[model samples]
Target: MSWPGGYGRRVLAEVDSTNAEAARLADTLAGPEWICALRQTAARGRRGRPWANPPGNFAATLVFRPEGDARQVALRSFVAALALYDALASLTRAEAALSLKWPNDVLLSGGKVAGILLEYPAGPGGPLAIGVGVNLIAAPGAEAVEPGAVPPVSVLAETGVRLSPEGVLDALAEAYARHEGALVTYGFGPIREAWLARAARVGEVITARTGREERRGTFETVDDDGNLVLKTAEGRVRIAAADVFF
Candidate 1:
């Protein structure tokens, strides 16, 4: 349960949202910090969707002052995704069962197992906060998910391996540090390659809904800038953000 050198850790009995806490602490952080909450009363996911965190599930946020523009900083989502894939592979030894969904979701046996939500920065070089939530012990009921959204699964439910929030954080923090280091040193070339290797539905037909525009296409590859590249009936499309469906 050790973080890599220089990373900070904080654990609380409860929090409204780790991302919210990170926002409050972002300005004062001297270095990267991982904050974990055993219970989140008001947790949330991307686009302000509600995130359910059961007692033993994992909910944490990593806050840091990153040196880069929004484009460069946005690449950390892929970094985090790869780190999550590695952490889960090590924890469950089910590397074959894990896959990285484009943008920010982790799929286990095709079920949504974890999610990443990066807070939109206030400016070019503003501090960044990345919120991650994993279903470790219990997943919310399938009925809780929106129509067409992937149903959730927990590590215990899927792998029969129960774990505490702290244990998951230990693995995640270390994994994140490793990928983040590569991003800082090698730029996104290596990270992109690594992420694409684990990516889901690269050659399959999928639907991407960004706002009111719904585009259907064969999933191509994530571009260097992290856009979703799709081969559509109209033509090649590069989407910066979208809700993908298969």
Candidate 2:
């Protein structure tokens, strides 16, 4: 498969982190570019947790100048999630086993198969980098994840479908372009509907946790501003960001 036209692709044998690489290259880029590394010596996940990127797994970052306010640019997490969902489904041919976890993780058979982390520039008015990691051939052991978090699973481990990181990137880049086009042209309405359809356990109880607090409630809808809405005993709560646990 080929990457969509006008998008740039780069494959590195190794890097400290793809997100770091994106930050370095963002200034030089006139268009969107994808950076994939075969081996990352150091990678970080949400809340600065260490991300385990095995030699054969998929670790990549997409860098582009975004439009709209902070909330709008942040909505691309959903954009990236939906793209990753379709990309994995298409490549593994196991669409039925896949579903999206809120705020940014992809699940397969109830186990985490991939994750997306978005990073904004340190300086003002700069590009955004969306880093994506997938356990293509191998997943870190359960010990690496947080307590009560979904166990990690790989595409190869679950589906017996072998794929290289670049192969996945080809499908992913194309899928992202399609979803991103919808976001840019029609607004978040279509993307929100599509994401909700693939969402996991929307009507069920779930817990959203942050460093300072935790909230448990029935998963409601994601609001127009991309906040996770939950119906709790106290009231309907909208969370802008948190680690969601089912």
Native-structure RMSD, model 2: 0.9
Q: Give the TM-score of candidate 2.
A: 0.98
**lDDT per residue (tens digit) for residues 133-153 in model 1:** 999888888899878888899
User: Each candidate's lDDT (Cα)?
Assistant: 0.90, 0.93
True lDDT of residue 170, candidate 1: 91
lDDT of prediction 1? 0.90
RMSD of each: 1.2, 0.9
Candidate 2: worst-modelled 10 consecutive residues by lDDT: 119-128
What is the per-residue lDDT of model 2 for residues 1-246, given as tens digits with 9 covering 90 to 100?
667988999999999999999988898998999999999999999889999888899999999987998889999999999999999999889999999999999999999999999998555457999999999999989999989999999998899999999888889999999999999999999999999999999999999998899999999999999899999999999999999998
Best by lDDT: 2
Cα-based TM-score, every candidate: 0.97, 0.98
